[model samples]
Target chain A: MKAFKESILCAGHGGQGIVSMGKLLAYAGMQAGYQVTFFPSYGAEVRGGTAHSMVRIQYPEAIANPVITHPTVAIIMNKPSLDKFLGRIAPGGVLLYDAAAAEKIPEKTGVTIKKIPCTAIALKLKDKRVANMAALGSLSKIKGLFSLQELIQCLPFIFSGKQDLIEKNTEALRQGFNEV
Target chain B: MTPAKKILITGNEACGEGAVTAGCGFYAGYPITPQNELTAYMSKRMDECGRVFIQSESELAAINMVLGASLTGERAMTTSSSPGISLMQEGISYLAGCQLPAVIVNVMRGGPGLGNIAASQADYFQATKGGGHGDYNMVILAPAGVQEMFECTYEAFDIAERYRNPVMILSDGIIGQMMEPIEVRYPQKSVDPDKSPWALRGCKGRESRSIRSLFLKEGALEEWNRDLQRKFRTMEAKEVRYETYKTGGARLIFVAYGTSARICRAVVDKLRQEGVKAGLFRPVSLWPFPYKKLKGLDKGTTVFFDVEMSAGQMLYDVRLAVADDSRVLFHGRMGGGVPEEADIINIAKKAVKRK
Candidate 1:
């Protein structure tokens, strides 16, 4: 009756590629044979200001509703998002934020908070956009629920004609996998 | 093979699979809340499966793109939520006038303009009663879950082709965002008749067929409306699907559809556990409204509870089906707010207690 799925909230700035990362995780779950639903916000509300995506994943015969009210995982790509979404994560849930951008990691309240230098690492690796990938890599390492292979499977879909970008992004993903 | 056992899925994803399974070769849509998932899912899956997926610039372009793709005789689809679907009404009317067989899915949300991205069934009147400006009707399918999403989608394409009309998969935010196990069956062989008589596939292999909805002659528009009504009447016979729950010895029937119906089913189960005889009537095909099946329930029922996401759109039709003294009632949770089972069960208890 109630849609009780584990929801993931990916929030950040526009250029940070938060929407693509949310879609990648959703598609990864769908590829893994899990029931997955991904919803993204649009227009002036989401871009550059307070962008966020809601992803709900569930097992068979479990939940009913899909809109993510209490995200089990909160991936914050910026400080504003970290401040806005720190209270939205479920208690004891995982909070992964970019240590390079996030100023204060919200009191580390009951949830698991990981402050990784995603931007610093991606920039060092010569690809600034791969911070979201680093966040995804960090998520995989922390949760161990989804696989790196699943994330890799979604690369070609995102980078259709730009094979060069795919190769660089794959390397960025690998560096992220190793960092976190 | 009985088309294999159906799996539970969200309504939007089901519609996407429905399009893919029905041989929809082209999908063009702009990202909007409540419907982005269907397009996002199609983005990856459609390409992998050899279908075209284009993220259009605006909702207007998306519908017009679908109209363009439909002209080529390809199974094409486009999707949006409320505001975006509103932008598409002009194109929808054009498609209807041109007799293009395209499936448009609207995963509804709260609206008048730029409304909060939350689940609401306020678009009921828009979808069922003439979303666009025209004396025309689109075959509307309101899927309750993933199974209905897939099955109704295939059937929607069939109806669109059969009647030479556009079909709308009217769903809400909850149905669009929710997730359940959805097992897609192998698509049935295309046995439905073709729409080539009016389709614009460059007019090859036959006389040039003009696909336009413009008829300026006197009484011609009236004739077209009457002809559309005739097609609707025929659709009423072939379409019109609903599900009955615990109607064997019921005093009150809860009439709902889409995700609201799913919630009503849960409430009905709760009431059944408490020994209350509350039944459920969920319509799968919303256009043909299932007035006959609903009228059949009017004979034995004591009351009718019209539970909806909005203030009451479908209730009008429910009233049309039941008798005058049947104690028709309304309970709505509008503007993207989901109703709890406790509230529905309480309504049932109070309805029975009043009697």
Candidate 2:
């Protein structure tokens, strides 16, 4: 396999598990024997506030900078995040967003935009909060950076002792991956 | 020897773990933004190790608690952000004057006066220049990544005890909150307070010993000051730690520390890839700064570019080291603004062109 390097940004409302998704991605990257850094930014409010995280994964070479200005991939879950971060994506980058929030995504020349009804999919799985996980699953399919199984293995670690939540999230991941 | 295990952790928590692994017997800290996680981590981990952890009522209480603990020769520590650290300056001075072995972790944020809860290097002067009233110096270590946060804090205790003086781990909010993988290693032996001969355990078997900074007799205070100055000189001579990247034949060098240095490292790689011979000089120990090492890297033809998150607080030291104001250039962002790689690259390219 060629050396891998990727900078991913996950952004949405505070209650949407945006930070959790970023952590899961970073943990999976570490498990795959890659160097990873995860940086989170949010307001004082624990819910309903804007939140985002930057995750960088690199192999063989050390990652020098933790803050990602122009992400290669972006997972946007709400309208505010989509509007704020869509134009910041690198040229030829991939953007995975929630269809519910991105009604008028402008066309970009080299970027690929995939709109998945992440919240709707999570509702089908009986927990709309896993919308972030669904979006992460779509990212996995688009980039093929890590297998769905790899992400599932990280569930127990992140949500330890919460078996029901883990099962529901695993299902949500599978659904999103299949949809993509 | 036991092998180190890889784990993902934030810089704040890593420093806490470093303290615990180094046999920190007591911890006292008040909650503050960008550094509250460290206090929380200690509340749990310190208890697990059968050590003492206190959520002090205020920053004043915390530092005094640490001082009390250190007087008994216990490995003691306290952590805080910019405003909180400012509140602890008086106690830090006393720690230095009394010649106590203690560690202080400053997870710095935007400063001057309750600036903001964002990453910053504004405390550079306060940390290295003896922020308190009297004359004293603290060994300051700047760690740029999560791994270094752990390693630096782990070694800080030993460095403090070696000189019987206080040591400070100067970090920023960015490093404090960012999570990365690090190898966690435990020390072979924990610190034992009983081994310290000067500890005021009691006057059971021998005459009592006293520790104080109040030397008010005729010329008595002068003798104490001389002793402190000698210790500072010895530290400057023996404890200068730094790292240089691709400076062998570079025409331009970026001098930075902490988060700014991390960004400069990437800029160096990008500049080199574009056929520009750029290098980086990062001072890991900020107090006993690697001044000689930095000055030696100056070839008469090279341009030294200084980058920081403050309004050139460290620039003064850089100029002093190079000994030439005209040979150095500065690029900085203040009030929680961080220096970006692209802007640094642009500035460095222009400098190279002019050179």
DockQ score for model 1 = 0.12
Off by over 4 Å in 2: B1-4
- Model 2 backbone overlap count: 0
Residue lDDT tens for model 1, B1-355: 1223334345677778877878788899999887777888899889988779999999999999999888777777899999999999999999888778889998999877888788889998999899889777877888876666777777777788777789999988877765444677656434222555655656556788676778899998778778877887787788788889886677888899987887788677768888888889888878878888988887554688888888889989888888663578878987777776667778779879898
Candidate 2's TM-score: 0.98
Give me the candidate number with maximum TM-score.
Answer: 2
In Å, residue A4's CA in model 1 sits off its true spot by: 14
Candidate 2 lDDT tens digits, B29-98? 9999889889999999999989999999999999999999999989999999999999999999999999
Model 1 sits at a Cα RMSD from the real structure of 6.5
Q: Which 10-residue window of candidate 2 chain B scores lowest in summed lDDT?
A: B1-10
Q: What alpha-carbon RMSD in Å does predicted model 2 have with respect to the real structure? A: 1.8
* Candidate 1 displacement at residue B158 in angstroms: 1.5
Q: What is the TM-score of chain A alone in each candidate?
A: 0.89, 0.97
